[model samples]
Target: MPQDDPWDAEASQHVARNPGRPKAGFYGAVPEDDEDGRHPSSDEDEEEEFEEIEVVPVRPKLSVAIGGFAALLAVAVALGAQTTGPDARLSYAIVLFGVQLLGLLAWTMALHPPAAGATAAIVALTALAADYLAVTGEPARFLPLIWVALGGFVAAMIGQFIRAEDRQRARDSWRSTLLIVLGAVAYAILLVLVRQPLGAQTILVCCTGAGLALLVARLTDAVFPKPRIAAQVPRGATGVVLGAMLGTLACAMLGSYLVLPFTPAKGAVLGLVAAVAANLIDLAVNFGEAGRRLAGEAPTFWLARHMQGPLGGLALTAAAAYALTHLYLS
Candidate 1:
């Protein structure tokens, strides 16, 4: 059989065939030749489309290492506070301020800065509170706890404000500031209520509960992705609040059983009530902070990180100190 003539087939096809057109091949269509027989326009278009992406700078490894070392040194100083004798107040002040500084440093250096700093501060304060409680072997008081919380709030705010970027400072809006103030007042009221009934023990129970809640919330986040919520609401706020409430209740029950020697059933009831009160305060403050941060108007304050965590720890410290002082006096 004779092979079909390509020229005859091309003549039969009505599609106008240009001699200059590139031939179709098994691979695919080929680029059309320009007047110059080169795809110069394509090359130029490609050049025009090229873009440079901006790379964000991260903190240097050396700087992060130095920050970690400094935090460790601050912890050592805080540990020395336990042996300060009559100068216990001064020592306590040192520990409190040192912890705040360490927190800030951790925030700047750690991969998950906020979590790193918050965890470090919580662990340090909790350990200190436990040691003091163990040494005193007595119930804690209220006034000292209140004072410490106030002092820590003031100190942390000042330190953070000083270090905050000028842009952050300028972005503070009146609405956010008002929210922060209201949150603080609400927290203060809650503290007074809990103190009236539970005394300084409220500090220990609340701090431990909040810490455990944070840990649980972290685990939950790892397991389940967070849902998108309104801008006013922070991600994971609901879960964290719920976790905090349950943790607070459990901690309170355990603490009461061990310290107050209450029956397990009675302790559980008290714990439940106390946890409700604590959760109310925590929920309000967290909601306020979340709104402020989302608005880009968060105050450069320690409480801005999480109102309950550091404040709770400081209150516990005050309670521990009061217990130790009373033990020494009696």
Candidate 2:
């Protein structure tokens, strides 16, 4: 019976002890199992999961706060340092720019709505104040009133965009981008048509139209959407379209600047170029952030879901475009 033992007793014991364990096959060391040998989750899976998480870096919050406070302090110091009364007031403008600029950069990177809106408001107010101071007499004194109204309008529009409670997608983004371009073109055309409408009246009409348009756009989106269109345009395509548009606009502006020296245009081509160039530069930088958003990366935690805020690239682009168009005309 002992002579007839057909199996190795040690091997049989090992097999019994480690059931289903990979074995040193007959050929070499343990033959790798036929299981999918990936590192558990795929890269796409990780990104999708990451996209779900809001990424608000702590450093930005602290840095922005410190910078904002320091800017205020600097403004106070500048005021104290000034010898003349007008200069002291002028220091306020400088302070305002410093604070708002720092805040704007932070809000843009952090993608926060309230913070960004506040920053923009500060900038507009400063500009208005500076304009008022630079002007002469009663009109200048009343200028702040006009600014107050304009500031409110700007604030409201930016707030509406920021607070819009809707999930973002490619088609919606593109549509918004188109509408913005159209709006800017319309405003530029309107300025020409209005000829010499009082500034106050012009501002009022523009604000009213903008408010109505925003309402209609929101309502239309809520009510309509076919299955086919949804399938065709995935979410976030708007960002890409906007990026391309900005880049193209920038290129065109540069081209015009290059050509300006050679030919004399009826209008101030150089001024147009300068205005567009300034706006395009800002847009170019912002589009980089928007590009990440479109790619489904969670770039900011503040306006994590909504990107219609002042700091939002799309909103900024529209603003910049309008400013560029108006720079020479105004």
Candidate 3:
């Protein structure tokens, strides 16, 4: 057949008239396997491999350690309060120190960061110092279980104090304070209804006094929170050494309960003096440290450090007072 005129042919004319489309691959079309083999799917495998993560519960060892420590602390305080004979007192103090160290160690391991961990270390050291000093006094056989219970009570009170202060929660409020006082008084009256121990009256008085003091202190803080001082005692070298020496002297004066023949009044005065001296010494260490310009790890510190000398002194004084009262009056 005669070829149509090239430009006049119908299909040729249509192609010339229409605009041309770009090639598929030129427009970013995904290229298929030219060889006809299927590619392996990395995405499919990834989807299949994905999982929902599950979390395992971690039991809190900190709480347990804290509880145990608190039990030991309360026991120590109560035992310290109850025991007086040189031998009995010394033995209890030793045990109290040991338990306190254990508690401090447990707390260090359980909750506090390394920086603050030194608090526990200081407490442990103080306990050791107390124990060492306690050795100068005679040893007696007393109830271990009592000491343990008292220690636990003291620990609980201390822990409670710490918690309350940290959260600024009041363990005792105006209402609670009133309640505690009234409850104590009520309990004292109840003591009459149900005959109790020989010295229940005095015991009641001390318990009530302690409770009231604690409540008052806490409530006062809650009402007017004051800035806290450095945990460690501040002092100059001379001051700290002086304080430590005073601490030592207080220990010796307290140890005198074993040797001294005096009234509780005399012991009380001596104990009071020892306590004051020891506290002055302890405070001086902190004051002295503050005066210096050096910086490093916080000195091992505890409230007990401030307290021990005074406590020991007071105990000795009380013993003396009791002895004198009994001897002269009897």
What's the TM-score of every candidate structure?
Answer: 0.36, 0.26, 0.24
- Which portions of model 3 show Cα errors greater than 4 Å? 1-81, 84-94, 99-261, 291-330
Q: Count of backbone clashes for each model?
A: 0, 4, 37
The residue ranges of model 2 lying beyond 4 angstroms of the native Cα positions read 1-107, 110-197, 226-290, 294-296, 302-330
lDDT of 3 by residue, 1-330 (tens): 787556667877788888565444577654343344533454566767884433222123422332233233333443444553434545555554554444344333322222233334434444444344334423311122224333433433344355434324334422322221121112112112112222222222222222222222223333332333342321123322333344334334433443334334443343334334333432443344443323443533453332322232222222233332344323
**Which clashing pairs does model 1 show?**
none
Lowest-sum lDDT 10-residue window in model 2: 184-193
lDDT of each: 0.40, 0.35, 0.34
Would you give me the overall lDDT of model 2?
0.35
Winner on TM-score (2 vs 3): 2
Winner on TM-score between 1 and 2 is 1
The per-residue C-alpha lDDT of model 2 at residue 292 equals: 63
Ranking by TM-score: 1, 2, 3
Top candidate, metric TM-score = 1
Q: Scored by Cα lDDT, where does model 3 land? A: 0.34
Q: Is candidate 1 or candidate 2 better by lDDT?
A: 1
Candidate 1 local lDDT, 1-330, one digit each (tens): 678766666675645644445465536757667697776467788777874433222223422332233234323433344234433444444454444444433222311222233333543443344334333433323444345444444433443354455325423432333222222222222222222334344333434444445444434434442452333443344445555556656765665555543444443444344334433443454455555555667354452344233333333333332343234212
TM-score, cand. 2 vs. native: 0.26
